[model samples]
Target: MRILVTGVTGRLGQLVARRLLESGHELIGIDRRPWDDAPAGIEMHSVDLRKRAAEDVFRKSHPQVVVHMATVTHLIERSEERYRINLGGTRVVFENARACGAEHVIFVGRHTYYGAAADSPLYHKEEEPPMAMTAFPELADLVAADLYACTALWRYPELCTTVLRMVYTLGPTGQGTLATFIRGPHVPTVLGFDPLFHFMHEEDVAAAICLSIERRIRGVYNVSGPQPVPLSVLIRATGRTQVPLPELLFRAALGRFGLPRLPPGALTHIKFPIVVDSAAFRAATGFQHQIDEAGAMGEYRDAFPAL
Candidate 1:
């Protein structure tokens, strides 16, 4: 299969493209920017979907499978710029994919789209309406990006769209709150609220993406890891001390310093737990990975020894 992958420079994108390439598929990768030591043999397209049309890449690759992995994880300083890159870019990717006659489009999204609240369901299904956008206005673009990919089916029924709603993904390249907290020396938590948490490994996520492409499965599916872990257990496993504090007091202190490390609007997730029911995807793909929380922390430690 000829596969065209967007955001090839991203860690997840690079890993997914590598797997597809190793499986003997023709690969074409694209990114707005380049990173050091790109994979060899795969053609890299230096195009920004937000700034210009991707028809050139779409026409040139002429892919049967289109993996849309490109995304803006961090909140860019400029509001309009962020919207263009995240939401606008997504619309363009699908537009070009359909234009090029691609058969399938694979999208990566977050489990948080279900919303994390006091009364939120412990395990979320794909049927739930997205509430995270309401909770976190900063995620509006991210949700919009997901909607753009899913709605492509209604707009173009011939295109098969796979929406993988991922939960707290952590990897050397992952920038999620879970990954960052694990890498830090100390973790701050709401005193008595140790919510259940689940994080997916980069390898596992890549494998699931590959499986979906191989099967050309359509519809939305939740992607997650084996078992759920508590916030306290996760911090202890990472060899980090938990600094329990009242939610209000902690927020006040964090505000003084602007929560320097975390991106704006992501602090809410640190307080709530959003777990997913990935059984549907697992049963269908039969996808499994060996990495667990212990391995995830080890990877972070190796990346930053001082932590």
Candidate 2:
């Protein structure tokens, strides 16, 4: 299948593109940032998603499958730029994909939609409803974009759409609140909270995505590592000292001193478990995480020796 991948410059994007290419799929990559060196034969287009030039990629690639990967996290301030890059980008991608008559459009989302309710389901199914938006304001744009992906299903019934939701993924180049949590030398946690977390390795995420596309699976699917680990276990495995603080005090200190911070909307996750059930995805695509609990901790330690 001829495929188009947006945000190919990102670590996850790069891996997904490489995986698809390895399977002999013709690939076209689009990213606003310039890539100095991309693998041979995969066409690269440098242009912002909200720009007119971005549409040319769809026209050029004539993609049968479009892997939409561009998303703005809390790293970008909560401003118009973030909204445009995320929400606008999704709107633009969907519009262009339909215009180009693309058959399948797969959106990569997160399992955080379930939120961090203390009593939330330990194993979340793909069909589980999202929270009522009590917290996670930093994720508003992301949630909006994710919901927008669903519109493609009914509005453009001819188009095939799938949402691949993964839990926190860790790898050498991965970044995000969860990634930053493990990056710090002193891992902080709520005094009495030890939430269960499922962190998939970068390679596993890429493989799951490739399988979804190869199998032409539709609907939403959650992906994660083999098992969920307690936040305490992860902290101990990383050899990082646990700095337990009152939840309120910790946020205040982080804000006042500009200390190492969790990615926006991550405070809730630290206090409550937020994990997804990956059985549906595995059954549908024959996908299973290649890394186990011990291997996951080892990979993380090897990547961040100082932590």
Candidate 3:
């Protein structure tokens, strides 16, 4: 299948594009600018999605599936930029995909839709309603925009549309919380025991995406790995001693120095246990996480020596 990957310049996008290629798919990778070094045997297109003419690029490629990974993914800082890039960019993709007559579009969403509470039941199905918006106003907006992006497909059921609500993915860039601790100025930890959290390796995330495109499954599905790992276990896995600090105290101390507070839903995230259920996705494609929590931690440590 000929696949078009937007945001091919990003870490996740690049990995997904690479995985698809490894699986013998033709790819047309589009980014705002050229990659530092283009991948072998793949076509690259430099087209700014913000520009109206960019739609023609997709139209010309005429891919069978579009793995829409491009977005302003960061939840903290750059609110205006995130809104413009994610909200605007996603809308543009949906409109362009439909116009180009692409057969399938898969959106990569986050698990924030589950809210911050740690005990919150892991979301496995779209039938499991999103938590009512409460705290995390900024995140609420981001999540809302993501949901809005998904809704565009509702208008075009004839098109195979899917939304993959992915959880914290751990990999090379070391952006996720687990990665942060492994290569941290200091490992940040919450007091009164840690909460359960879910993660998937970057490779698996890319694979699941490739599989979804290959199978052309439609509708929303929560994508995550096996059992959620506890925070303490994560710390041990990293071979780092976490400095136990009360959440309120830590935030207050950081606030005193005028450091930006964690994003709206973040505190709720560490306090609550979240396990995204991907059984439906597994059933559809027989996908399983290649790296579990401990294995993922080991990978991060090896990639960036644990202090």
2 against 3, candidate with superior TM-score = 2
Q: Is candidate 1 or candidate 2 better by lDDT?
A: 2
Clashes of each: 0, 0, 5
Q: List the candidate 2 regions with Cα displacement exceeding 4 Å.
A: 255-259
Candidate 3 C-alpha lDDT tens digits along 104-175: 998888776766654456444566656625656566555765687678667877678988888778866676
Question: How would you encode candidate 1's per-residue C-alpha lDDT over 1-307 as one tens digit per residue?
Answer: 8999888887778888889889999888889877567667688878787554467878777898888878776642427777888788888888888888999998888787787788888889998888877667777888888888888768889999889898776666736656755555667777778888888677887888899988778899998876878888877765667777787766665533323254445556767778999889888887776687678656755665434
Worst 10 residues of 3 by lDDT: 253-262
Model 3 error, position 262 (Å): 2.7
TM-score of 1: 0.92
| lDDT tens digits by residue: candidate 2, 165-226 | 88887766636556676676777788898888888788888898898898998888888866
Candidate 1 lDDT score at position 81: 76
In the predicted model 2, the residue pairs found to clash are none
Candidate order (lDDT): 2, 1, 3
Candidate that beats the other on TM-score, 1 or 3, i.e. the better one:
1
